[model samples]
Target: MRTHWLSSCLVLLITTLAVAQKNTQGISGQVLWKAGNFMPTIGTKASVPKAVPVVREVYIYALTNDKQVDAGEDAGFYQKVNSKLVRKVKTDKKGRFSVTLPVGYYSVFTKEEKGLYANLFDDAMNINPVQVQKRRWTKMDVVVDYQAVY
Candidate 1:
């Protein structure tokens, strides 16, 4: 009887943990970096440009408008942003990262040496905008390629 009771308690604990995890929502995705020559060469022995997984820090900020970001001379680099930073996460060796956040719209940026980097925008000019839904993990893949020549 004692063994039965202990087993029941263990099962209850596991179930509760699983339910708690399922109820939390956030974002999960990978980051890739493309560098060097990306333009196609017609000559023989030409190789395709490849993007590799990059291990870096990812920043989540409140949904940012175009005016909020101070654009840099390069395409994707930002000098700074006026939006509030919501959270930050570091990517694993394989460039995979996950973060728990409330359901809302957010802007994603990857840490760079000079500044922050993000290459996407919406119709309203929202920079790197992502939406986190209730009880769901939003998937977003960020590619950093400011150094690469097109």
Candidate 2:
């Protein structure tokens, strides 16, 4: 009798959990340069001797209302599952890039720099709408300035 009741309860709990799960979509967007494009024509060397264009890794982070658990959080809900040192990708010949992020709320930003270039995400991070549907692709185009706080 007890075993029967326990099995029934377990099945009910499993069913409830399954029903509560929702399929989340992924979002992808591109970052393009507005005024100062940074690519070159064919036969151009990788590095330009005179001027060093914006050469750094750009990362897209998923956000939940500006509150997040860092490296000390437990491996549960609201945990950083895919946290790692994202590789640096250069912009296209036209200073454009694209990245795919999991479905959730997020804001796109770049790291800070010094001297002529300063950290952009310091004051305000460039924010945009993020919506990832199961069968649909949410496209966003972002333009980042030289000095903007995140």
Candidate 3:
């Protein structure tokens, strides 16, 4: 009877640990935006654009290849994303957000008035690629600067 009880307790402990580990693994980050005129005048002191936190919806999709996204005519805009969307989360007023996902690679984007926006790409052309590891939280920041002139 004692042996049976011990085995049951061990099983319960292992199950608890597995659940805890799964819950702790995912991604967290903030979204920032840069907008307005950035061009500097020759006689005036150069005023660079400062990035500010923006509250918006963040979309997570499967690791997307270059062919999965359609480029817009305007800079930094995407007309469409053909990849499968995994999840989406809204940022707080301060632009901070966190999400739980299984361990794997994902592509992230922000909803834009024109469509979707993402400014990053890997060497292999993966759009805004991020990796979530087991028992770890991957930190990533999405910068929305499509309306800003550089």
* Candidate No. with top lDDT: 1
Clashing residue pairs for model 3: none
lDDT of 3 by residue, 24-120 (tens): 8888999999898877778878678788999999999999987888989876568888989999999999999999898999999899888788888
TM-score ranking, best first: 1, 3, 2
Pairs that collide in candidate 1 are none
* C-alpha lDDT of all candidate models, in order: 0.91, 0.42, 0.89
Candidate 2 segments whose C-alpha is farther than 4 A from its true place = 1-27, 34-56, 64-90, 112-129, 147-150
Model 1: residues >4 Å from true position, as ranges? 1-18, 41-45
In candidate 1, what are the lDDT values of residues 1-150, reduced to their tens digit? 999999999999999977976899999999999989988787668786799999999999999998998988877788988999999999999999999999999999999987899888999999999999999888889999887888
TM-score of each: 0.82, 0.38, 0.77
- Number of residue pairs clashing in candidate 2, backbone atoms closer than 3 angstroms, sequence gap of 3 or more or interchain: 8
- Give candidate 1's whole-model lDDT: 0.91
TM-score of 2: 0.38
In candidate 1, where is summed lDDT lowest over 10 consecutive residues? 40-49
Candidate 2, residues 14-113, lDDT tens digits: the string is: 9885554433334434454333434565786654223223433454555323233232232112223133322334455544555444555554444433
- The C-alpha stretches of model 3 lying farther than 4 A from their native spots are 1-23, 37-45
